[model samples]
Structures are given as C-alpha cells and as structure tokens.
Target: MKAPPPNILFFLTDNQRNDLLGCAGNPIIKTPNIDRLAASGVRFENAFCTSPICAASRASYLTGTSEKRHRFTFLTSPLQSAYTDISYPATLKMAGYRTGLIGKFGIATNGIVPSLQDEDAVEKMFDVFDNYEHWTEEGYEIRQPDGSVRHLTDITGDKTINFLRTHQSDHPGQPFCLSVSFNAPHAQDNDPRCYIWPATEDHLYAETQIPEPFNAHPDFFRQLPKFLRETESRVRWQKRYATSEDYQRNMRGLYRMVSGVDRNIGRILGTMDQLSLSNNTVIIFASDHGMYYGDRGLSDCWQLNEQSIRIPLIILDPRADENNRGLIREELALNIDIAPTILELANLNVSDKMQGKSLVPLLEKKKVDWRKAFFCEHRFHRADIPKSEGVRTQRWKYIRYYEQQPVYEELYDLRNDPHESFNLAGDHRFSNHLKRLRRRCDKMSAECA
Candidate 1:
C-alpha cells in the first residue's frame, strides 16, 4: 500500500504585520523561533491577503476563494454552508485526515448571527474543534476543568499541545491536519488598556526604543480625504497614539504580545521534536491579515495600504529537497492560495471551484508562470470606512473608493515610493501609466467580482 500523507500543522496569528518578524527586518521585535522556522523553510517575501479584515481573510484562507465569491466581507457575516462543505478542513476530514482547530475561529463566531452559532452545524467540519472568540479585559481568563485560571494564550498553547499529544497517541498511523490560531497582538477593542500580554513577557522590550512609521507623520493625515480622516481607523489612532508616551507604551505592549505568541510557538516546536513528529509534518505560519500600528495615522487594518494587505508567509515541508530548503521566493502569494497548497501537499486534487493555484511548483523551485497582480477589497456598512477595491502589482498600485461622494482614487509607483508617501494620480507625466493601470484595475475588479 502507498504511504500516508504527511501531517499538517498550521499556525495563524491575529493582526500581525508582515514586517514584525526579525527575519522580515524588524530589529525591535525578537521573533527568533519564527525566524528559525523561516530559515528552515521557504519564505514568500510578497504574500498578501485578499481582504484586510479578519472574517473575510479567514474565509478566503479556508475556501481558497475571494470575499466576492464567499460573501462574508461584512462584520458578523457567517460562512456559507455551500463553501463550508468544500472548505480545506471539511475536505481533508472527508479524505480521512483527522482535522483539528483551536483558538480564535473568527469567522461566523459573532453571536448576532443565530445560524453561525449552531454548534452541531459547525462542528461537523472538524474532528476536534475548540473555538474561542476575542478576549476582553474582564474575560481574558480561561478557567480550566481542574480549577486553574490561566492567560488566554497559555490556555491556547496548552490546548494545542494536548491536541497534538492526543492525536499522536490515539491515531498513531493516521495523518492529521491541525490549525492553531492565536488571539494575541490584537488589542481588546473595548478595553482602555488595549494590547495585553502575559506577565512573564513584561520585560521583553523594556529597553527598546520604537521608531515611528512614515505614515505617522501629521502631514500624511492632513493629506487624506475627509471621509478617511474621520474613519474609525483615525479614531483609534487618536486613542492609542495621541502622545509620545502613549505611543511607546502601546507599541511595547503590542510587541510584548507578539513575543508571547513567539514563546508559545517555541513550545509547540519543542513538543513536535519531542514526539519525533518533526520530520513527517509540514508546518506553515501566516497571519489572518496585516495590522497598522499608527501607520497612515491609522490604528486598524481596513485600508488598501501595503501595511494592511501584506502578510508573512512561511512554509516548511519536511519532504523538500535539501537545495530547495531555506530559500526565499519573491512571487506574489495570496491568502487564497493557502487551501490549495495544503490540499496539494496532501496529494489530493484541488477543486475546480477553488480559484487559488497551488504553490507546489514555487516551493519546489520549479519554473512556472505566476500572477503579475492581485486584487484586494474591503466592504463595510459604516460610511466612515468606505467600500473600496484596488489592484496591486510589482511596480504599481491603483485604488478606488467607489462609495465616496466624489469618487476618491490613489496611484502609487511602488518601485520609487515603497512607503506610499506620494500619490501620482493627477501627475501629467504618469497619465498614460495611470490610465493603463486604471483599466487593469477595472477589468480585475469585474473579473474578481
């Protein structure tokens, strides 16, 4: 008989920017474990999320499709049954792989939607599902069955370790796909203290000085459209970044939360090694979407800026050739590609309905034609955060706020202006280039829609 497929371990974090990792060039944030994982695996330098919001991007990652196809872009929207039937976890479970999910299952968890809260309806997709939502200031405690209360991150790590140990012991010969999602680094929206980390990590970045991003300059906020300047992003920015002391304290808290997550990752990796499962497992690490920590005078991630769209992507396939390991690919990878890549690694055929292409060729360092550009979108009922769409390529980015009273547009030449400090939409010198990109953007919007 043929050998069973490799076990899959996916680690997902919340509201983490692509640049936060030490391997990604942030000297301040010490993500040594994540850096080591990137060193042992293939890292994609330009991975992006199809949508910048939590629910939408998570849906895309599971279904291998865009928000337009899944129709879960808004807050409290539930994942449709039609797509859940073919989601990565559901399909893998159907194919005889024991599937498990832990931590923030953001999609469809909003209690406002009754159908989404149907336990029996959602639990059928995975063999072991432990769902937890955002932790508030008063509710961050998880009282264990043994009467021990622990930090949410520690509880999450304990549950994950238990799942791994149980999976190995109960089903030694069966392949398993486990997804561990962490809620750290994403601040508690309703709390005044905002970002929270474990007590042990309080001293992680005590002596570090955090530098302000280009977008944090007052001039950047002055240049934004009135609608955007008044959005919730700006509101949160005022709350968290109004003073230098506030900025330093909040930024350090955010980094501390990230380091706490990194420590948990170290524990998980150590457990895998102890179980002798490191060689036969494929580990992938990524974030649901990027976050803006005072970037563009914004504190959240709804805009079409690079800080919101780009995410860190690392894949470690134990079966990879020696030469292929420890390599970095500059290809454009999207969150939608995750499901397809997982299925490909499992030696299963990708569904025709899934729009994302497999990344196996890129992982193998084989020659293949890849996408030149990808589309991003954000839709919301609130008027402050206007519904928007854009197309981003290697050299150019074109965005359109279609819902604004007078349609707002932005054009950036990424090669020359990586920080997007200057907008060239009205410049006569780039009119022809702008026209071509506008046409491409419109075409892609319709195609993706």
Candidate 2:
C-alpha cells in the first residue's frame, strides 16, 4: 500500500519583518522556537508579498494568485465565490484532507466577517474555523469557563492543540491540514499602546536598545515626495515613532509579541511530539507581509519597498533528506507560491488557474529553473494610500504610481542601494535601464491581469 499523505501545519504571523528572528540573523530578538524550526528546514532569504497589506496578501496566499488576478483588498467588495471555492483549504478538503483554521480569517466572502452570518459559506472552506481579528479596542482578554482570563495568543495555542487532540481522537486514519494564523506582532492601530504582548514577554528586550531606523532623520521625511509625506504612513509614524521613546517602546513591544508567538509555536510542536505526529508532518512558517518600524519615515506597509514587502518564509518536511536540512535558499519566493506548495506536498496536482509555482522542487534540492524576479503591486486606492505597481528583479526595482497627475515613478538600484535610499528614475545615465523596467512592468501587469 502507498504511504499515507503527510499532515501539514502552517503558521502565518501578522506584520512581521523578515529579519526579526534569530535564525534570520537579527542579534536582539528572542525567537528560539522559530530559530530551531529554521535550523531544521529550508528558509527563503528573499521571500516577498505581492501586495504588502493583510487583505490582498492573505487572499493571494489562499488562492495562489496575485492581488491583480484575485482583486481583493481592504474596503473592496467580498472576494468572488469562484476564487474562494478554489482556495487552498477548500481544495485540500476536497482531496480528503481534514482542514482547520484558527485565528484571523482575514478574507471576506459573500459578506464582511464579524457581520457575516453565512455559516454555510465558511463551512465549505474550513471544516473547523475559529475566525477572529485583532483585539485592538478592548485589549486581548478571553474569559474562560474556569473564571480565568487568558491572553488571545495563549487561547490561539489552546485551540490549535485542541484541534490536534480532537483530530487524533476523531479521525486517526485521516491526514490533516491546520492553519494557525496569529494576529500578534500587528499593531492595534487604534490603541496608544500600539504593540501589545502578553505580560510574560514584558522583559524580552528590557535593556537592549533598538537600532535607529533607516532614513529616520527629519531630513529624510522632508525630502520625500509631497504625496508620500502626506500619506497615512506618516500619520502612523507620528503615532508610533514620533519620539525616540515612542520608537523604542513600540519596537520592543513588537519584538515581544513576536516572542510570544514563538512560545506558542513551541507548544504546538510539543503537542505534535507527544501525539507521535512529528515524524509525518510538514510545517511552514511565514508572515502575510513585513512591517515598517519607522523605516523611511513610514509606519505601516503600503508601498512596495523592501521593509514593507519582504517576509519570513520557512518550510520543514520531515521526510526530506538530512542534507536538505538547515539549507537557506536565496530564491525569490512569493506569498502566492504557498498554496501550490501545500498542494504539491499532499501529492495533489497544482491547478492551471493558480499563477504560483510549487516550491516542492526547491525544497527537494532539484535542479529546476526558478524565477529570477517577480511582479509586485498595490492597487488599494485611497487618499492616504496611492495605487501603484512595479517589477522587482535581482538588482533593480521599478515602481509607478499610475493615478498621479503626471504618473510619478521610482527606480532603485537594489545592488548598491539595498536600503533604496536614492531614486534613480530621474538619473539620465540609467535611462535605458528605466525604459526596460517600465516595459517589463507593463507586460507583467498585463500577464497577471
């Protein structure tokens, strides 16, 4: 008889940067569990989100399509059923995988959630869905039947462990897929605390000082284009990083929240070991998108800059050879590639409609021709957020704000200016390079559409 399909466990964190974890070479953060996971798996050094926002990026992860193809972003109408019906969870369920979702179901379907009453619609996607959002206004308290209050992060871990236990008890023979999406590390946005973590993590970085952000000086803020300087990113910067004290507190809080999530990941892995499931499970850890901790005088993610788009991506399959362990791949992996990767891991064929390619071959160390670069875009139209798209290659990044009166453009030589401190679009010497990138950007936008 053929061997049973491996169980899949996926963990997605909110607003986390690629360099925060110890495994990613950050010297200050406490993420031991995640670091251990990275040491045993393949970590993608250059993973990015096509759209650097929750709604669009999460939708891309689910549907294996770009935001341009899926057309789902904040304040937009609910995602079309055609796309939701083909979501990774839905497809895995159809293929005999018992799927479960815990924490923030960021996408809306047929209705915006917390107001969405259609239980049948959600049931079609996840067999066990515990959907929620960040506890911004009221704080992160969930009273249990025992009269004890628990943090939202702890409750999320409880639910995940409970899912593993219940699955083992109810469906011992069936392989499962569990998605644990954590709302930690994302700022409250409305709360003055900005970033909140469990009290347990209050002392993680109590004495260490956070380094000054890239281009954090007032001169950098003054030099920005008027449209960008007046945007919400700057508004949030005032709220979170207006002072050195504010910057230190908020950055430490974000790292503490990340450490809190790391603790829970340890709990989940422990549960897998206790249940004898460690040998047959594949685990993936990533974030929807990266956050800007006052990078370039920005607070939240909206622009296609490195700090806003780069995310942490790690995949560990227990069946892989020992040589593949601890390997770090400097490949250009996108959030959209996740669904296809999960499907391929379960021995299912990837759909033609899915724009992303499977990452299984990369994990196996197979000699496959991989993408050298990828398309990135942000189409959310708002006064504070501009509508723009771009093409990012190994050494260059070209962005265009098509909605601008004169269509403003930006070009960065990523090789020399990885921080993207200088704009090369106006430089006459790189005119040919600019023209080539512009045409490539247009062609990519068309292809994705």
Candidate 3:
C-alpha cells in the first residue's frame, strides 16, 4: 500500500552560519537537539544562500528562485504577488495541506513590512500565522499571567506546539507544513547591547573563551579595497569587535542566543513525538544566511565569501530506511532548492518557473548529474553596501563588483586557499584562469537573470 504524505516541520534561523552547531564541529555552542537531528538525518556539507542577506535570501528560500530572479532586497519594495503564488506554502495549501507559519516572516509585502496584525496578507499564504521580530528591547508578544515576559524563542516554541496539538485534534487525517522562523542570534542593529539572549541562557558559555578569528589580523583588513573598508560591514564590525572585551561579550551573547533557540527546538520535537507524529514527519533545519565574527574585520553578511554565504541544512525523513539514516551528502544545496524539495515531498510537480531543482534524488541516493557551480548575487545597493555578483564552483570562486569605480574583481582557488585569504585575480600566472572564470560568471549571471 502507498503511504500517506508526510508532515513537514521546517525550522529557520537568522544570521546563523554553517558551523555554529555542535554537530558542525563548534565546541562551545550548546545545540544537542540540533546535533541529534543531524546525527539521524542527512546534513548537507556545502549548503549556501544565493544572496547572503536576510530579506533576499528568505525570499529565495520561499519562492525557489535566485535572488536575481526574486528581486526582493533592501533596495526593492515587497515581494511581488506572482512569486508568492508559487511559494511552497501556497502550493501546499492548494494541495489540501494545513499550513502554519510562526515567528519572523521577514519578507516584506503589500507596501509595508508585515507585523502580527497584518492578517489579510498573511492569510493568503499561511492558514495560521504568528509573526514578530527580535523584540529584545521594545516590542514583545507573550506575557504570562504571572506578569513575567517570555522570550521570543520560547514564544516561538509555544506557538509551534499549539499548532501541532490543534492539528491532531481538528485535522487528524490531514498533513501539515509548519514553518518556524527564529530571530535569535541576530544583532539588534540599533542597540549598542547587540546580540541579546534570553536570561535563562546566560550561563551557557560564560567561562569559555571564543578563539580569535584566524583572519582577524589588521593585515586582512588592509587587504580590502577602500570602498569595502568604508562599507557598513566594517562599521558594524567596529561596534561589535573593536576591542577584545567587546568581542568576548558579544560572542558569548551570540552563543547564548543560539543555545536558547536550540532549547526551544527540543521542546518542539518532543511535542511532535508525544503527539505520535514523529514517524511521519520530515524535519528540515536551516538558516537564511551566515554571520561573520571579525572575519576580514566584518560582522554581518552581504559579501560572497564562505563566512557569509554558507549555511547549515539538515533533513530528517523518519520513514527512510535505517541504513540511510545519519547519511551525509556533499552536493551543493541552495536556499532556493527548499521550495522544490517540499513540493516533491508532497507529491506535487515542481513549477517550470522555479529555478531550483528538487533534492529528492540526492536524498534517495540516486546517481544523478548535479550542478558543478552556482551563481550568487547581492543587489542591496547603498552607500555602505555595493551591488555585486559572482559564481562559485567546487574549486574556484570569482566575484566582481560591477558598480565599483574601475570595477574591482576577486578570484580565489578554493582547493589550496580554502580561507580565501589570497586573491589570484591580478596575478599574471593565472590570467587565463581569471579570464575563463570571468566569462563563466557573466554567462551564469545572464542565464540566472
């Protein structure tokens, strides 16, 4: 007999890198729940976000397209209605799945950034929507009857648990796709006390010393061009990493925030098991993009480097064979591939308009021809942030800032210099290699556009 469609529990985090969890080899962060999930599932070692910023990357994850195709960034208005129509949630709803979204739907729409009060816009996509932000300083949503405030991460877990309980009671036979987006570990840009965490997690990494970034030396910052040195990335770095004291305080806060989120994930997974849904639920955990801690003296994500673009992706299908459990895949995965994966898992056809390919074959261990390289772009043009595009292959990367005066380019051979410390673009010995990659970048950009 054919099995019923599996439920989906998609978890997303903001400003989290590919190596922040315990399973990813970070010794300090406490993420036992996520680590266990990775141990029982498939972890993609080379997952990346096409755009290394929040709004654009989140839109790409929802719409299954490149940021160049979606065109929703800081410079643009809300995401277009056409893209949302093909989104995974909307498509799953059309296929009779109960859909819910909790916490931090960061994509803007309808001429304004959405809040929890915006029901009309959210209803078209999610049947149950609860949207909020970091709320570390001013705004908050949940207050206990005892007059104590709940942290946003805790509130997110509560909402997800409520959805599962309600679904079991009301729609016992129907499957659900619940998306939980956590706004933890992302620095409150306006506040000087950046990277705030729940008070409950204050003791997580109190005494542990965070190792200094390998590229935190002044020489690395000196290697950057004047335009990049003057950008907002550097300004943000000054606020968080200007001194050793500030770096220690902020890094500990970041670690605690991540641990807080991990704690809530444990609660959510426990609820799924208690409700007898674990055997039929597929959980996908990932982040919108990555963060930088003094890497090249930068603190935020916008550049095309590994620290900014690489993100963690874990998929756990409980129905898969026991032998296939805990498998790791090395194929390159992108945020855009998420929508198509969800659609295929739900037994729907991937839209021709979607640029991402479904990862079902990879999950099933099928021999297939995969992409050798993928194109990445950032279009959030500002005085501090410049527009740029690039192509990243397995062994090489080429980035060009077309908007810069005289057009600056950067090339790195990833095989030898995995840290991307040396630029080979200007070397006469690699002129032919540079020319080849430049042409490839241009061709891929045009095709993606």
| Model 2 misplaced regions, further than 4 Å | 109-120, 135-137, 145-147
Please give, for residues 228-311, the per-residue lDDT of candidate 1 as tens digits. 889989899888987888889999999988888889889999999999889999999999999788888888898889999999
All candidates: CA RMSD (Å):
1.9, 1.8, 2.2
- Candidate 2, residue 139: lDDT: 56
Candidate 1 Cα errors over 4 Å, as ranges: 75-77, 109-121, 143-149
Q: List the residue pairs that clash in candidate 2.
A: none
What are the lDDT scores of the predictions, listed in order? 0.85, 0.89, 0.87
lDDT of 2 by residue, 277-379 (tens): 9999999999999978998888999898999999999999988889899888878999999999999999987778799988888886556788977899998
Clashing pairs in 3: none
The CA lDDT at 131 in model 1 is 80
The runs of at least 3 residues in candidate 3 whose Cα sits more than 4 Å from the true structure, single-residue gaps closed, are 109-112, 115-121, 135-145
Stronger candidate by TM-score (2 vs 3) = 2
| 255-296: candidate 3 lDDT, tens digit per residue | 998999899999999998899999999999999999788888
Can you rank all candidates by TM-score, best first? 2, 3, 1
The alpha-carbon deviation from the true structure for residue 147 of candidate 3, after best TM-score superposition, in angstroms, is: 2.2
